[model samples]
Each structure stands twice: as structure tokens, then as C-alpha cells.
Target: MNRFLQQPIWRFYDQSISMKYNSPLESFATDDTLCQLVGQLQSPPTIRTWVHDAAVVLGIQDHRLPYVQQGMKVLEARGYHPIVRNSGGLAVALDTGVLNISIVLSEQAEALSIDAGYDVMVALVKALFPEAADKIEAYEIVGSYCPGSYDLSIQGKKFAGISQRRLRQGVAVQIYLCIEGSGAKRAALIRDFYEVSLQGEETKFAYPQIVPSVMASLSELVDASLTVDTVVIRLQQILHDLAHEVHMEPFHDEELTLYSFYLQRVLQRNAKMLEPK
Candidate 1:
């Protein structure tokens, strides 16, 4: 068990239910704000869960695609909004069935190594679904979108991807769990995006060659009927069991001001990234 997971108290916020902060832009901004709050010792370690309707979040490297605009059009045709994220990693698909979790912890006392942060998320996900503990593995799924060292997979099929952000002495370890629907179908979207964007041109960064079959939803992997709501309940239960207390403490008014600042910065950066080249 990771020491970070056993914090004395954790602040819990569930935005997936209300769908109020469902946009990828707002979600990223909120994470940044939480990073600042937690890093400054204004808030305790926080766990946030969220979901977006239909989005394809591109990475910093993704913006360099030769035909990127046309690639975004493909996603838009399928009712998915495409936007670049302020994090490291390639493109990833997000829909109503996907659940996003962020474990924000302060580094005031001790800083977490990059791998340590990822390990904590892996441990939590394993704890969340104990039945699949033996099957779950953390290794890069070659044909999966956003392939990384910490890609969560069953057998050779990936169901989740984790990324991290460090700001203001805080570390936010975030993961998007494909809980329902077709993970391969989502992978197909990214495959198409890359094929169109790359146009067989070589680039400095080696964007993934996504194989749709290499990805599967958690429900698909475990052979169980798992939904976003049920996963949220399970996560809450796990938090309560791990920590002495879990509080549903949302942002204070002052925190809202920080959120707004981050929101604008994210918005501005996204707009700038997508500008005509």
C-alpha cells in the first residue's frame, strides 16, 4: 500500500454526478486550482472524480500534427469535441462512461518521485477493484492511445491511462478509467485521428500507432456490469476505509477565484494551441 493513500483525512469531491464541471477545460483548470490549494497547505489531500460528455483531449505534441485541424474534424463529426490538454501524453478519448480521478497531494513535507506518484494511483485502482487485482498490470500497451509506462491493462488490453501534473509544490496524479462502453471504439477514434493528422509524414515525436483491439473497458475486462456511478460508490467506500475521515469539502469562495484564473489560462492556452498555423 502506498503511504499517500493512507492519509489521515482526504477531501472528496464528486463532480461526475452533477455534470456541472464536465468540460475537459474546466476539469483541467479545477485540478490546477486544487494543486495550488493543496500545495499551499490551504487544503488537505484531495480526491476528485469527474466525467465528460464526449471529448478527445489532445496532448502538447498532438498540436504539431500536419493536418491536425482535419483530424479534429473527424472527432467533431462523431459528436466529440477535440481540445489540447496542458499535460504530457498523447490524445485520449473521454465520454460519459469514463470516470476521471485526481489524487492531489502536497509536497511540503516530502516530495514524491514521479514513479512513486504513478504507483499510488495504480495501487488505488487495484484496491478499488480487488477481484481483478491479480489480472491488473501497469505497463505500456503498445497500440493503446496515450501509451505510457503506467498504462493500466488486463492481459494485453488497456482500460486506463494515467498522467501527472506538478504545480506549486503539489502533485496531481490523474487517471481516466474506461468503465463502460467500447474501449476499442474509443481507440479507433484516436487511430483515425493519427492516421489523418500524420498523413504518413514522419515527426520528431513518435506518436502511437493505435490498435483498436488493444483496449477494453473495465466492464469488458472483468466480465461484469460496471458503470460510472457504481465505480464512484466503490471509490468513496475505499477512501473511507483507507482514511480516518473523508469530507465532501468543495472550494471556498476564495478558491473559486483561483479556479477562475486557471480556467481562463487553460482556455486561452487551448485557443492559442489550436490557432491556424
Candidate 2:
């Protein structure tokens, strides 16, 4: 039973546990909760979408920046809240223009390779935009924010990047797609952030040297104006068409209760990361 080939997808896009509304922490914690629920088979395989307004989600490694405090201040002053996420990747900007999709898979289906998870997302994203699917390629977009091998690109400019989180018996493959606004401006923001954060301090891990030109929004790449809401509907339709059963499942009372615990776990982890030295 290949899960990817024959799993019913539960849509949890509109109904999520991010009660905090604008807090990226809420979004992150909710993902953790969903991962746990799906892991325990309390919930079906799920697809969730979220957008946090004016936020810069940092990787754990990003906390080591020589002047990270100052770098955070820069982001704050620029109207973006800076947060450290437990997910894979570094320094991604989120706003109304950016849309995040998480595909939750129950480990019961089988143990899937990392590439297999990423391929699932890449395939879905391409499927969502068949008009430009042929041009969308996944590779490491050098000089781009959060550069990764699964970076989804058009020509040489990247529009999205895939990341993942594994917990208990579930795997959540996540991707952030730049759907509208200026992707270069977002890259430039991170570029300036690193300049302030690094401040000439050498670190064990090499951070990306962001080149704004290497990043772009899907609208820019595809030459069409796209909005998050529009994409959300399209994604839901695609999933509905692909799966024999598509159910709208929200968090149950037990899951909500569990969310409080996971939320604290995420909060504590973030506190440790952002704790002042």
C-alpha cells in the first residue's frame, strides 16, 4: 500500500489551531500537533495551509548569529516579526503573499525516503500549476534564501523551497511558496538580515549569501497575477480530484488538548533558542 499512491487526504487548510491569528508560533505549534495526531492515526493524511503576516522564521542555526539580537531588531523595525521555527530551513519570510502547505503522512503507510517526501510536494506544486509545470524544476538555487536541493524554480530563479518535519509516526512535508509581491525584496530583506546578524563573525555552518535576483514569485515567473486565496482553492481542488476520498477534518477535542502540550514544547524550544546570552 503506497501511501502516496492511495491515501485519502484530509483537508485542514481553513480550520487550524492557530488561534493566535498572527503568531508564527501558533502556526508552528499547530503543525507539531497535526504531525502528532496524524502519527497516532487520530487523523487521516492531511494537507494544511497557513500564512503568517510579516514574519521572518529563523532556523535554529540562525540563533548563533554574532549579532542576532540586532538582526532581530532590524527585522522588527522593518515590520516583520522574527521567530525561530523547529522546522528544517533558515530565515524564511512569511506574509500575506507567501503560502505554506504541509502534507502530513502517517508512517503506517511505510517509511518513505527524504527525497520521496520532497518529491510528493514538488509533484503537487507542479500539478497545481500544470501550465508552467514543465518549466518548474527542483534544485539548489544558489544565492537564494533557504537554498535547498528541493528548491522549486523557473529558469534559474527560485519561487519555493521544500522542508520537512518528522515526529512520532508521521512525516510532514512542508513547502513555502512565494505567490505574490516581490520575491527579490524578500530575499534582500534576508540578505540585509544576515549582514547584520553575521557582522563578519565566522560560524561552523555556512549561511547563504542571498542574491535577490536569484529568487522570484510564481506570478513573476509565470507572468500571471496569483493570490494566496486563489491558490488555496486550486490546491484544494487538485487534492480532491486526486484522492478518492477528501474529508474536511478539523482538530478534535483530544487533539486540541494535545495541542496545548505541543504548543508549550514548541514555545520552550523557541525560548531556549531565542534566550539572551
Candidate 3:
């Protein structure tokens, strides 16, 4: 158990239930805005929920693949706009069916560590589904896309993947929960992506050979129809129970300015790296 997980803070905000935009651009903008707010200590320990239309978010390493164009094309043909993210992990699918949650806090105050950040996300998921909480486990589901040591799963089927980003003194631990739709279909897309990108070339970075059966949406795993909104509401209930008060507020103007600067920097970096060199 990490110390950060046990630390009791005076201020915490559960902004996780807010209905956000469905556009990828808007979601990216919100993430940048929240990161800036956290960096400036203008916000409380914040939890945010977001969802975007069909989009394939690629990790930095995924962009380095020899034939990434083919992978992008495949995603585009399947109604997903492939964009490389300024974060760790390989390709991940995001659609209306998926709900993304971010927990942002000050590293100095939280005494945050890498594993601590992941544990926070794991704890939040367990809180969200108490009935299945004990059944949930965190481990690298071998054949899952964006496979990681902290992958959130139940009965060997992965439902979420976690990643982190730090800006200034703030650390944002993010997770994408597959709330609905066919998780296997999403995995199949990434499986095809890896095949197209690698094209039989032996690479040192061993991308997972995806087994679609090992992944499933929360709806499937819970045996009930679920949606992002339902998960979002549950996340709020959990956070509110844990916090003094959860404020529903938008980003301030200064935070938006900082986000603009950071967003441009991230986009520029992506463009330069993605461009044919």
C-alpha cells in the first residue's frame, strides 16, 4: 500500500459527474485546462469525467512504428480519427461508449509516486462498483491493448487502462473505462493496427498480441446495460462521499490561457514527430 493512498487531505473535489462534450477536441482541451488548474493549485484535488467520439489515441512509441500510416488509415476507415497523445502507453480506443476519468492533485502535497498514482485510479474504480470491487484486479492483461501493470480487470477481462501525466507540481492520473459497446471490437482494431504498423518487421518494443476475448465493457462484465453517464454519476457519488464538497465549475480564464499554451506545445510536438521526416 502506498502512503499517498492513505493520506487524508483537507480539500478534495469530485467534479466527475459533469457532462462534457463528445468531441475529441473539447475533451483534449478540458484535459489541458484541468492540468493547468492543478499545476497552479487553483483547484482542489479534482476528479473529472469525459468522453469523446470515436478516436484512436496513440502513444509516443506507437507513432514510431515503421508503417504508422497504414494503421492511421485503418482507423480512419473505421470512423476513428487517429491522434498521437503526449503520454505513455500504446493505442487505445475512445468512443461514446468509453468514459475517461482524471484525478489531478499536487505532487508535493500528495507525496505522489508512480505506483501511488495508479493505485488512486484502482481505488476509485473499486469505489465505483463496490459489489464487484473485491472481484476486480489490477495487472497487465497480457493480450490487451495498452497493456500495463495497473490494467483494471475483472475475471481476466480488462475494462480499463491507466496512464499518467505530470505538469509543473500537478500529477494527473487518468483512466479510460470501457462502459459500453463491444470491448473485443476495440481490441481487434488495435490488434489490426499493430499488425499493419509492424508489417512483420521484428521490433524491439514488444507490442502485445491482442486476444480480444480478454477484454470486455463494463456492461458485459456486470451483466447490465451501462453507459458513460451512469458510470459518471457513480463516480460522482463515490467522490462526494469521500470529499467535503465536490464543486461543479469550469476552468478559469487564466487556466484556459495556460492550457492554450500547453495544448499548442503538445500539438506542435505531435505534428513535428508525425510528419514524414
lDDT of 2 by residue, 1-277 (tens): 2348356556555532243247788777888888888887878888888877889999988998889999999999999988899988899998888888898887875787899999889888888888898999999999999998999999999999999999988889989899989999999999999999999888888999999999999989885678887888887787777787888766778788988998898888888999886
Name the better of 1 and 3 by lDDT: 1
Per-prediction TM-score to the true structure, in the order listed: 0.98, 0.95, 0.90
lDDT for each candidate structure: 0.93, 0.85, 0.78
RMSD of each: 1.0, 2.1, 2.7
Worst 10 residues of 3 by lDDT: 1-10
69: Cα error in model 1, Å: 0.5
In model 2, which residue pairs have backbone atoms overlapping below 3 Å?
none
For 1-277, candidate 1 gives per-residue lDDT tens digits of 7788999999998998675336699999999999999999999999999999889999999999999999999999999999899889999999988999999999999989999999999999999999999999999899899999999999999999999999999999999999999999999999999999999998988999889999999999995688999999999999999899999988889999999999999999999999978
TM-score of 1: 0.98
Cα RMSD, model 1: 1.0
- Looking at model 1, which ten-residue stretch has the lowest summed lDDT? 14-23
Better candidate by TM-score, 1 or 3: 1
Give the C-alpha miss distance for residue 177 in model 3, angstroms.
0.3
The weakest ten consecutive residues by lDDT in model 2 span 12-21
Model 1: per-residue Cα lDDT at residue 259: 96
Q: Model 1, residue 103: what's the lDDT? A: 98
Q: Going through the candidates in order, what is the number of backbone clashes in each?
A: 0, 0, 0
